[model samples]
Target: MIREQLEKADAIEARIQEKKQDGAGPEELEMLRIEKARMLRPLTHPNANERVYLARRIDRPHLKDFIPNLFTDFLEMKGDHLYGDDHAILGGIAFFHGRAVSVVGHCKGHSAEENLACCFGMPRPEGYRKALRIMEEAEKFQRPILTFIDTPGAYPGKDAEEHGQGEAIARNLAAMSRLTVPVISIVTGEGNSGGALAIGVANRILMLEYAVYSVLSPEGFASILWKDASRAPEAAGKMHLTAEDLVEAGVVDEIVPEPLGGAQEDPGRLYASLDKAIQEALCSFDGMMPEEIRAQRWEKFRRIGNGE
Candidate 1:
């Protein structure tokens, strides 16, 4: 169903590009707009797989993609100091809404070679270690920390295991939990397993509408439980991975609604709204002491599975 919508949307986009090439009239532009909006109606009412599709949408903006539009003075810091740097996870000191903060997140690549180089945004041991290093620096400077999570999961390869993938994630969780600065996390897209959890132990966690935050991708879960990945849509439905689901379950502090259909449909509006949401969350932590913030976060997670 979502695949069909994607096809239709792509067709409309092509027509719009063609019109631009030929110099479209006002009537042609109007028709194109109406057709695009009509095609999006059903997709806006998305199911589980559609939610996952939006999370991985190629048109959706990424961490690095937002730099020029949403932030400035991005002085990137590299390497974990113990090991080499991982391109999959990148971070730096940046100004968000005129306030300096440590910004870190998964960086998905645009080309096939780039994707392979970054391990398709699936971080390994070095990536997590690098995140910890930058986060500790944020705590030292008394700057707030902001993390953008959009990864399938930690790298699950022989090399990753050899270098302590599990230990890296565990250490990040511990380090982030004890950090004294206010930390805010946003699930901008796919947030899977321990990779997501490592950066998500923040004072407040927010998720974009249509994004998925889960222990495993629906296909993976479906294959394990039903012996058939074809049942992924059903698995997605049962997992409660959508931002709406997380909000209702008290797993997320807030849901930042994407523009009408989704973020990709209107990147400008989406980024503007996201900037506001980040600012508001930061404001909410204004006078909070480190211990108070930690206790609040701890209690918040503890209550997620509370009450049968």
Candidate 2:
């Protein structure tokens, strides 16, 4: 059902783009807007598999697609130096607003083959290790770290467990929590489990409008409780994974609004908003000492479950 809606949405978007090229009249634009809105509205209330489907949508922008659009002179650094180079996590130095900083994000391929290579944005032990190494490097140079989280979770394969996936994630949490440099994590899409938090220990956490973050996916939760994945929609509503819900629960610091429908609809605009939010966050922490920043971060997380 959602697939059909997405296809129709894609067709409408293509038509709108074509009409614009041919100098679309206001009436044409308005008609196209209405058609697109219908598709977008239904998508806003996605079921569990639909949530996973949307996260893997071809139209959904990936970290690589947006980074180039957001920053200049991005030099990618590779390898964790132990297990191997994990393509799921890409890290490097980039100039954001003329300030050099380390940026890391989960990379998902736009196609099936690519997704396979990326493990569907599910990082293995090496990926978390690579991220920790990058964060350490960022701290060494006193550069702030910006992490774009969009993973489903850590890989559950036996091979991943053999390589110490849990330890890698734990190391990241411990290291990131103590690192003096400011850290900002943005949940641009699905942020599931320890995979997300391995790099999510940040001073500021922001999430896109349609993005969801949780320890487990809605379907997984539904299966455990209701024994039916079909009840995922109810699970999603209860999980409070949406940006607005996270913000209200104090789990996320801010809710970065996506373009009218969602980020997939306007990647450029989405990147711009993210760039601005990051810049503002960096500026606000300018004069604070490392100890002050660390204390603030700890305090923020500690207060999340306190009753109001």
Q: Judging by lDDT against the true structure, name the best candidate.
A: 1
For candidate 1, give the lDDT of residue 298. 73
After superposition, candidate 2 runs with Cα above 4 Å error: 1-6, 17-34, 37-56
Predicted candidate 1 versus true structure: per-residue lDDT over 1-308, tens digit per residue? 77787678779989998998999997998898899888878766688778898898766778878766778899999998988999999899999878999999998866788689888889989999999999999988999999999999999999999999999999998888788788999899899999889888988888998899999999999999999999998999999999888888888889888875678778888888888999999999888887888787777777878942
Q: How far is candidate 1 from the true structure (C-alpha RMSD, Å)?
A: 1.4
Question: Candidate 2 lDDT, tens digit per residue, 129-203?
Answer: 999889999999999999999988899999999999999999998888898889999888899999999999999
What shift in Å separates residue 204 of candidate 1 from its native position after superposition?
Answer: 1.0
Candidate 2 vs. true structure, TM-score: 0.90
Number of clashing residue pairs, candidate 2:
0
Query: After TM-score superposition, what is the CA distance of residue 36 in candidate 1 from its true location, in Å?
Result: 0.9
Model 1's alpha-carbon lDDT is: 0.87
